[model samples]
Target: MTHSQKHIIGLVFYPGMTSLDIVGPQQVFSALPGVQIHRIWKTLDPIKTDDGMIVLPDTTFENCPSLDVVCIGGGLKQQAIVDDPEVLEFFQKQGKTAKFITSVCGGSEFLAKAGLLEGYRAATHWAMRQQLMSHLGVEVGTERVVVDRNRITGGGVTAGIDFGLTIASILYGEDTAKIIQLLLEYNPAPPFDAGSPEKAGSELVNKAMLFIQEMSDLELASSVA
Candidate 1:
């Protein structure tokens, strides 16, 4: 990266995406120097997240500038995004030259669908990890963030923070990443130690699995309707 060139990042936004998946990384990237962030979509319209929060896109797929990093955040409507030809083509185009191709959660599915993850190892939400390995032939990872060469991926939702910091450290050095971490007060002390399936136990994990399946079914039905 030349000092004259700005570090540009394109964060894909689409309906039904998880807000934190993009926002967390955005917050971390925003604190860095000489970086430009673009919220990109097929259109410049307002996008509604899975949780009903509305976000506006600043750039469209056709008009987005070349990016240093191309990232997508995932959620329940992943199939829809993956099935969209335009989205897949856009990702394919960006992946050709983007220094880093990345995603959080099920967003990696989009890259997989675009044929960008063909030879890379990746990390995604636990819910989608099996499918990526089985269906897409990706070397799915179990870590919070997985970096295979230029493909930097994050685990489900909250791992975006760790993912961002990891990318930051790689781009700007550990000292700079530490400075940004301190500025953001990036400390984690959750009230419960139930962040993972193993810790949450079978009961909670089963319930969560059931709920996620039900939601997926409903969303699939709704999309068709």
Candidate 2:
């Protein structure tokens, strides 16, 4: 699928952005020919991820060309994305003309914060599902991947690959995406089958509660509200 004008897909990164949130889905999108991927930021300075991955922006917020899709990666810095009204405004702008707009984990929450999910069914990692619904009034679901109109979403980090494939299929065709999947050998298996809440038992669920203690009280309160 070659368009004379490159279809640009932009991602916003900041301190603590999830590495997998950007890379996992990125591989899938980059696999497509003629689709350009860009690291977009408020500035052109070097950026870092939550897990110590250093990245350079391909473009800045003011200089970026029209986006075919704009996805915001999510992690601990999701609060920052939520706080930046300018970033949300950019999403709303690109989203209006973008052929498809989507997110992976808490990225869905960013989309909601941008006021782009109004009256649209969206999905995010189950952990942020409550916050997305509470702050943005958008319903969240537990699907591993979701496609409600032009908006696409997936569960946490692990679901990004699936999310990307679904987006590719929507853009090109099932044939194109399936071939790419086969080339990439996307068939996945896990040592443990406890990836999602449905697959995990109470013990795993309980252990996860311990990690929640690390999050700020504000996020927890908003999430629980």
Q: Considering every candidate listed, which one attains the maximal lDDT?
A: 1
Which residue pairs in candidate 1 collide?
A: none
Residue-wise lDDT of candidate 1 within 27-138, one digit each (tens)? Answer: 9999888899999999998999999999999999999998999999898876677789999999999999999999998899999999999899999998888899999899
Model 2, range 57-151, lDDT digits (tens) per residue?
87887888888877876786567567687787788788878877888888888788777788788778877887888867998878878888888
Clashing pairs counted in every model: 0, 0
| Model 2 pairs in collision | none
**Candidate 2 clash figure, as a count:** 0
Per-prediction TM-score to the true structure, in the order listed: 0.95, 0.89
Residue 207 accuracy (lDDT) in model 1? 96
Span of ten consecutive residues with least summed lDDT in model 2: 213-222
lDDT of 2 at 115: 76
